[model samples]
Target: MIDLPIDLLITNKNKDKTVDLILSFLSKENYPAIQKITDSLMYEASGRAFIKIQTGCNKFCSYCLIPYLRGRSQSVPVSQVVRQIKTAQKQSVKEVVLTGIDISQYQDGKAILTDLLKQVLTETSVERIRLGSVYPEVFTKDFLDLYSQNVVSNVKNGRLCRHFHISLQSACDQTLKRMNRHYTIKQFKKTVAQVKKAIPGVSITTDVIVGFPGETDQDFMESLQNIQEIGFSKIHVFPYSNRPGTLAGQKEKKWGEVFKKTKLARAKKLRDLSKQLEENFRKQFINQTLGVLIEAKNKQGEWVGWSDNYIKFQISNPNLKRNQIFKICLS
Candidate 1:
């Protein structure tokens, strides 16, 4: 097997030359993409599987190089996606996460993300499906409808997991504007509120950049305040770093250095708040039962898996085995 990084496989222009060299060495044709492979491969020993439905990014967020490095957003055909899921089901895979660099932009011909989801639900017998990080604007009527009709209504059946990890890089409007994010804080709030209303007990998580180019003290404060108000169950914190070709990277050179210590301090504060928010969100589900897909045992020798709401659960039951779905009560 080739050991090339995923980025090289996806973005390298000289892939033909690389493959020719490999073929000369090994006397075999090289298949660059996994989807191109026409043979049955061993599924993961774990119950869960991650299927890449889309890749690359089109948003061109100022802080990101995904567009330059990964190229434009491209989606796997819906037929291919369905076939993969069906294969996974036949292989006894219990759960599948429709993953991508930016799955929010998934489109295949006339079919959008919602349409793909509908097809997967109807055509495949996969027990659980989850999504990768999504843009705030992805909450269109059709997307919400799929959740309401297929997901929320089938909570008992565990068809789709009710957790969303939104790509909210910065909560401050000014910082977000500088980052070239399409949606405003107001729009994000509205979308989030709508999601909460539609699916009660849905877990909302997000990514936050602690320090961005040209972010003032006031901007940081605004972001922190808004984050608290939004009450995200978990936060993935990133302290801004310069990438060679990114607009934010060039802007950072002109904007002068934000103290490394200062960035760490901000990150620490946000992380502490995340712990509190997560605790609070989990507290609400205390004494409640959730359908958890048993993945495997943790390092501590306890059975570990994730609930439908994306909360991690650890149990020490000796009778439990892998690939089993059980309704577990939170203590």
Candidate 2:
């Protein structure tokens, strides 16, 4: 069976001339090539807008194929990002998620991710700005300070989401080394501690990959211990999958593989731990007032929305409307 680019081609057929240019690459016949970066902006008329500030990645994590597929990191101009956010605000988008393959590596001339964020907050009228996953190592003191200020002041006005998702593939140093993760366990812990101290009541979330090649039982135990100690509000756990053409996959070809059952068992354990941590985090906010952006009505007719710190909640108020921000006490 052959897979064609029919859906993508059709979607962009009349909207973009670049579609024909891209289709030529998939055709069997040789055609003149034109080089250009794909559009980085994405939005809906009245909902959350996702703006891609950059594309590709420079971090070549051992198990990932993103670098190979997307090429080296490249960021959109800061002016363009600010303009896109303004457009989203004009379209009545209540929330905007600044996304990228590696947004922490974003740079346009002298501007960095911090500068881009500042520009958005200062210039755009978007009600809420959410960030995509970022590397813990990139959360420098200056960035943390900026975030602290924003969370304290902007959160009340619905300008920023007081939540951060950092990617921590493994908490065990040995496993992280094998994964080619640059930071050490100690460094990661320090970074997390600093962030927590700087931004009180902020929600910290992370991703953990279990069963990486060469991970031992001791390593898994250490990972579990570290995760419990960190007390992340949310954890995204994944069992390591061997992606061909990557460093880990190549190493697996040379060495033996870890048992699938062992990987599943470890992943399940971490997922259960994640649930406990999430519940604890949510409990802390009980009886506290939070700013929630009403999203939609559930099947039971209850209004559903997300708090500034990313907590999903439902209210029984029938008069509430979507796209409105309201302060509600968590019960």
Candidate 3:
């Protein structure tokens, strides 16, 4: 086994200072060092790219280790983000996903995520802009107002996709409180309502965790009911897992654990509910015209792409190339 010298700076949240320390150490040891803080624009051969505008997380949820691992939030300058998007556009990239560890907390000087979005719309010629997962609490009225203006009614020319995947760990207030999620179920529903009102036909997707420690049957039922009522286009259900060094993990270690069979049963039930909800959402678009971005041909030689609402679609056209946008009626 090779032994390597490794130093961790968990206490130092400033990335710049961390880099400086590493460089100084390397220079003193007469070792060559190269550093690049800003990431270069990357274009996939399929004409898609992901632009990271921020990094780190400050939300210390009970079950999440992200805060400990990533430290506080730090945003990339809007100018840098716009520069990368423009470069990707020049390379013929049709879609770009604005990603971050916690995008809702993204801020560069006086500009927030909404401000950065406006600049991207005004400056870049990218066909579609997809946002990564965002926190529901950050969906303020001002943000929604901004979104209402730029969201393209016509998918062909729309720069922003009509899909939002907000993180909702649990719908039950008690369970959410235990997880330290920082928002109530009612607040989440209100945000969802606001989003749907601002952007008609917008698809909302979410993440749900079941069988968290101390969750009662009543809590699970509440979660299930709320999930069904929300009518998410897609639901990603995950069974709670104990992550080392997390608050939940420590608590589980101290207390008796829930039965594995029980957790599995809960997960399966939520997954079934998710499938039903997805089908229901899909049925709503039948015979309706939707815009799709042709990504690639599937194993059966049928062209496949995602709609603006993030629906997977199979087109009969064999002549279509990647990155081309086409309108089709869902049947």
Cα-based TM-score, every candidate: 0.89, 0.87, 0.88
Best-fitting candidate, measured by TM-score? 1
What residue runs in model 2 are displaced by over 4 Å at the alpha carbon?
1-35, 44-46, 152-158, 253-256
**Per TM-score, what order, best first?**
1, 3, 2
Q: What lDDT score belongs to each candidate, Candidate 1 first?
A: 0.82, 0.82, 0.82
| Model 1 TM | 0.89
Candidate 3 has what TM-score?
Answer: 0.88
Q: Candidate 2's residue-wise lDDT over 157-177, tens digit each?
A: 536678889999999998898
**Per-prediction tally of clashes:** 0, 0, 0
Error of 2 at 257 (Å): 1.8
Off by over 4 Å in 3: 1-37, 40-42, 154-156, 253-256
Winner on TM-score (1 vs 2): 1
